[model samples]
Target: MAYKPLAHIPTHLISGILGVGKSSALLALIQQQPPEEVWAVLINEFAPAGMDALLLQDQVPQDAKVTFAEVAGGCACCLANLPFKVALNRLLRQTRPDRVLIEATGLSHTRELKHLLTGPEYAQVLDLQSVMTLVDARQLTQYAQHPLWIGQVQAADCLVANKTDVYQAEDYQNLQAWQMRAGLADKPCYLVSQGRVHLQWLMQPAVQEANKAPTPLFSPIISASSSSAYQAASITSTVRLTLSREQLAASWQTWYQQQQKTWGTHIRVKARLSNMQACYHLQAVGAEYQLDVLPLEKSSPLSSMQRIEVIAVAAKEDIQNALTLWAQELGILDEA
Candidate 1:
């Protein structure tokens, strides 16, 4: 059956940096979906393996009317590209969703993505609602001056201080200090745990032109060339592992420490692993890492395969070679 011309479908852009729990936030929102409404989610990942969708698929309520599409391996900020437009158009036409949620990659430039959504082509199709940017108060001091981080914050209609359950008193203070210093004191800010934000925040009308901060002088991360000073690369693998959860986590932590000595401290790693006993999720950034045991019953067929994604501000070749060597060393990848 033919549907309406895709006009005014409530859409929200969920933006954040690496390891800030964008997928977690989307999962929480999906669980809150109205019983009668259909929701379509479009997720973009910086790495080719694209594990976020797999991680979320089994976690969403089995009864919710939710559909998903993903754009992986590259930033989806460029509307001129066919991959992004095709995925989005196909989703809207096929699902005829009552609401839409877009989760952009952590390295994405939201200003461009927002511009495209409001442009003539999609302006009528999507009722661009709120732009919610999730922030980890703990990273304020480390990434406050980073241009990409600044862009995400400036494009947000509201800021969510996620992972607050683990935050210390000083983390809260840092958030306030950064907000005032960044001239975002007037913007709505909410503190939540495990990426849970009230549904009301998603309904807030987006005022991008009025609230957006001035564009930064440097090139946006999506458009940066190989020669650009802000170099970064994402290396991913999909080989099943033979090690236990504890052994896998320990191996990664050791690898991270070794790489830091050569590549400095800027890095992010995420992996999903499963063995006969249980499934696990691992996330690491800077000098710290966390490994969580997940319910085996919730595992999908895709979850059975091991997946690893490493994103760092180092040479692509260097990162790839290092990961291959590390995996082989751990016997996760066979020597060829």
Candidate 2:
């Protein structure tokens, strides 16, 4: 048997609204990848302070060869084309990685970026892995009325309707309506919480036959499971907990069930475990579950860190309360 050669660097373009958890999702992905694999992350933040770039750098594996690029001052999709090209060129020239993750600012144009990556010049360097859009469930009503929103939805290779943890029963009804409005009923858009995504789905290739057909609301290539659950959009809260090697797996199962119940429609729970030998991970996007445990360096600091970074995607009050509750369950860190 023979297989088509995979791209040298599987780059993902993550685009979404300003507060829709794009940065958080990028952080989670960085946490999951092995350090020795060599990955380059390019973040183009719209804000002037470069805060998102700083946060992403902090999450990188210390020993991993990582290059952080910041295109600040304006929307990368509009005013930063040269900067975007420079960043890509620099990453390819300096630290050649197996994959690159581009976290696009809310106002950036997905189609433009796709054009740039798929253009003849870039084809020799970067592989366009996928264009993923993050949608706000609570804003579905508004999104349905906006032309730009429809454009964004149409351009995505994968659509993640995030913050499902806060969506009401009526919201899904509205979501179905919204889905119909966008003419994306056939596209494969998963209602994921806390940016929880299946690495397997990310790694898999797009279905060539379906890719040639009319627009689809979801990817036909996605593997289905009896346990997978899909939800409407809503708020979401995430808490990362560090556990002992002996206590880790069992503790996660208990927490996951409690999370699905307590946050119910208001949460999406994801976990990453880094012990001495490897990093074991699990993500429940609605009812779907995926597990992967990859080997790590013996002397890596991952084991000692034993840290989980939880993010709440709804309101400030909800975030504070969720953080408080999690701190009690997972123990808060003392001030340095």
Candidate 3:
């Protein structure tokens, strides 16, 4: 089928870990696009704070006009199907945006999310633009080096490497090697820090100008999963807490490191803090020693509590244990 960027409303998937700077890049793009061009934003998270939603609202440049919706509970790729529908349905009803930007949770499986958008249900309503996955420069060094990172990096139409500020002393040669191994073709890899993205590259149309453009390949987890299969493996677990600002800040990095060490790459994490000082933080672990996080924002509805959502690839029993351990650490697993 011939895809037209204008024939259908184009939406982007800004995905990475909790700290890589997806929100930063989104802000940069929104800042560059004329207000009339921006349509709406779909912000998904694993947490409830919705801080990123608010920050993006404030950063949408005075001259820009855009609307936003927030989806939290889990990765929109997995748990938040209804929320996705509710958010998009409402946005579609109220605002007909030229473009839509979906800020996905860090742990979100971009391939899966793309499939959902391209599925028959939403195919007519939305056009799947490029799947943009943000990579933390530091973590990309580690993630792209992992055996399974190819599946993640190669799936992206554009692999944005955020946190360039942290890579000044690092070697890009390693990254080049990793990119080659990931079979990235001529796909663009951008280095951005403090949320600086190349607006021209991002805002350009995502549809193939012609049939000769290479077709992006999706992972089996996404392409092969039937609706029943998706329902069978999907588990939505929530963690709520009432920590003071100090405690919340302390738990952020500490909890991540702890989960990284304990889970050993089987868990995915996302959070939105109420402080509004930080963008949503998220972490995703796949195979052994593969972990990364980046900051992200989109927009969704308001929430009354602070929560985090987790998703993993495991049996129900294993997922239950993992969720329990995670909740135990936060001291709120029993609340629900």
Stronger candidate by lDDT (2 vs 3) = 2
lDDT of 3 by residue, 42-154 (tens): 88865543545655664454445777788865677567477877887788766667788888866566666666777788777777777777776455434432322333455
Name the regions of candidate 1 deviating beyond 4 angstroms: 1-5, 78-80, 210-239, 330-336
Q: What is the TM-score of each candidate against the true structure?
A: 0.87, 0.58, 0.60
User: Which run of 10 residues does model 3 get worst, by summed lDDT?
Assistant: 226-235
Q: Write one digit per residue (lDDT tens) for candidate 1, span 1-336.
A: 556557799999999988797888998888788898999999987777677887787577555688889988768863354788889999998999889999998877887788878778888899998899999998876664466677888888899999899899999998898788778898899999989987788897787574355444333333323213323344334556678877877788888888888876677777777767777877777776788787777776565666667887787788788877876755655334
Q: Who is ahead in TM-score, 2 or 3?
A: 3
Q: Return the candidate ranking by lDDT, descending.
A: 1, 2, 3
Q: Rank the candidates by TM-score, best first.
A: 1, 3, 2
Clashing pairs in 1: none
The better-scoring model by TM-score among 1 and 3 is 1
- Count: clashes, candidate 2: 16
Expressed as tens digits, the lDDT of each residue in 160-259 for candidate 2 is 8787887898877877776776676876677778777654445543222211222334332222221112221211123323555446566555665665
**lDDT for model 3, on a 0 to 1 scale?**
0.56
Highest lDDT among the candidates is held by which one?
1
